[model samples]
Target: MPEHPWDQAGPRFRPPPGVTLYVPVVVAFLVQVPPTIGVGLWLRAEPRWLLLATALAAASALALLAARAFPGLTVAVVAAIVTADLFLPPEVGPPPIALAFAIVGAIVRGALIWALGSVGAAWLVVVVVGGVNGHPWHPLRIAAATLALALCFAIGAGIRRRVERAASHRAQLVERRRANDQAERARIARELHDVLAHSLSQIAVQSGVGLHLFDREPERAREALASIRRLSATGLDEVRGVLAILRGDDADSTTPTGISLTPQAQLAEIPALVAERTGHGLTVTLDDGLRGRMPRSGIQTAAYRIVQEALTNVVRHSEAAHAVVHLSCEDDVLVIAVDDDGVGSAGRPEGGGVRGMRERAALLGGTVDLTVGPLGGTRVLARLPWEEPA
Candidate 1:
């Protein structure tokens, strides 16, 4: 279920549990009771008035125990008790410390209206009733009380804002992590698809050639079997390298499976890739215009994958006899163009292979497109931004 903003904010400033929540209650009780009792005795007040003063102080302190759970009601009850204690003989009652805690608790817990209304009503009653009872009105005392109450509200509001900001930051962190995980998963999927698809397609073709030449030409059949074995071994090594990377191991090191966990194929391997296809009965040529100039590792990887997927599609769908892969750097952009002479891509639906190619190029701020080539077949053109080495 979707979470509300308040629900996310609440846990950070939620009331404490067990004995921690009651610490304030205990402290308030101690502060109120002893002071009230000592003052009443020192003043030699009547027994009945002294007892009333102590009881009022205790009731105000006890009310705070429920302030967290029932902030509005607790504040209102404590306010009434404190006001009643004020009518007692001078210095007979302790300070209204408990009421301050209740008011702050109420405001912090989002009971602002209740807190303000309760305090306003209590203040009005005190002023009207004290004046009627012939008690002198002191402007200084009223101003001090107003300032104290304002400070409590300010403290509560400040605490609430801090908690809310912390909660928001946590939420943003979680969202960023989720997005990164998804992107990593997608990258892994594309890697696996490129590795497995090309490897399996080559294996299938070699197996067919081996079976067909088994009786007519035994030597060619053995050669086909050897090619199948090499493709399978290379495919396994690449898969292990990918797995080692996902396991947080160094891809440049050897793994327990006796496979050197090398990084993915890059620009330097394009000639070997073309030679492999040429050996497999496809006329493939490589034009390396950049010579030894290589782009960064990330761009090289993306470009290599794009070329690999383009070749795989040609072998699987183009039915082309001759193909050419052209690599060049123009104006700080790496351009890869693969052209073939065979049946065109006239009505071929876009598949995962094509989508994977586009995704790889896009990840590196590049693009891949298919068009009719000068060779009268399909052309796969990819352009990727390149950063020249210093």
Candidate 2:
């Protein structure tokens, strides 16, 4: 696909190329001498008339240099030169190259109407003066002049349309790239949250337990250390899988896509998660009353993450010992609610976990709300569509 030259600055006046300005000056001056000499010899005109004609032609060519800056001025100057050439003492021909250059500049710089109006006015003057100078009324000449003006207008209009279309295409490509970037960011965020949130929460709680039990119960302290080692290993594996995907590595030996080297947490693993929390002295309960079982992997994964983040918040922020997770289906919505008896409040400050929950819910056309729980602590309520968007 050919890119538009002016996409970076749409619909704006552009300076003419250096070649365009200088080449016209040379060409106009060279062409003007031949006509001036011919008219001088044919009419036995004086040397002053030739000098006047040459000066007007040179000035008109210089006018093209400033066409983009002042297109109307260029057109007006060219029109004045045409008028003077027709009505002067000697019959010097109009500076056709200079006038054409001015007209082209006006069109490219968005002053077509002004340029055409000036040309028409000059042409009218030429016709009237030509008749008074013993020139006959020639229909062919009139028709040819009209056709030339129309052709210039048509070519300018066509180029303008092409530029507009190219600008639109460039805008669409930018928007599409932006949207893809946002989507990719969201996907990576979800993966990191799912992989790290639960593992980190378990490690923090276990570290605290192991320190407290270091002298009193050496066996349980050892168990806590063991749990930390397991969680760390799992977290590392998940991180490696994510890195492989980001690096565009070849498919893993087990999976075709290489996107998930470790098994993802699903709704079925809520019981195991509750058991793990129980080991850390946090009484975690699960109540699953949803009529729909695992509608899709995305919804199930999202549900698990919401519950996991909520429980993690309970473990980290809420000073409560007991937490309850409730999952139910209402109409076409799947609701996941986590409540605790900790010192959490709806007015308390939130972190990335809360934001991640909200973003995940929003992507599914649902919502995540934080409010005061019945147990005098913070509650997380996430609602998502049972059937995912296509």
Candidate 2, run of 10 with poorest lDDT:
250-259
Per TM-score, the best of the predicted structures is: 1
In angstroms, the error of model 2 at 209 is: 2.5
lDDT of 2 by residue, 273-351 (tens): 8877774557988888964467577888788888888888888888888999999988878889999999876566778
Clash count per candidate: 0, 1
Candidate 2 TM-score, true structure as reference = 0.76
Model 1 residue 367 lDDT score: 86
Question: Superposing all C-alpha atoms, what RMSD in Å does each candidate have to the true structure?
Answer: 5.7, 5.4
Model 1 has an lDDT value of 0.84
lDDT by residue (1-390, candidate 1, tens digit) is 123444454544545575645876888899998998898889898889889889989998889888878888998899899888888875335668888888878887778888899889988988888789888559888888889988888987887787678778778867866777677877788878888988998999999999999999999999999999989988888888877777778756975557679656789989988887775557999989998999898889888888888898888988888999999999999999999997989898988888899988887778899999988999999999996233
* CA lDDT, candidate 2, residue 293: 65
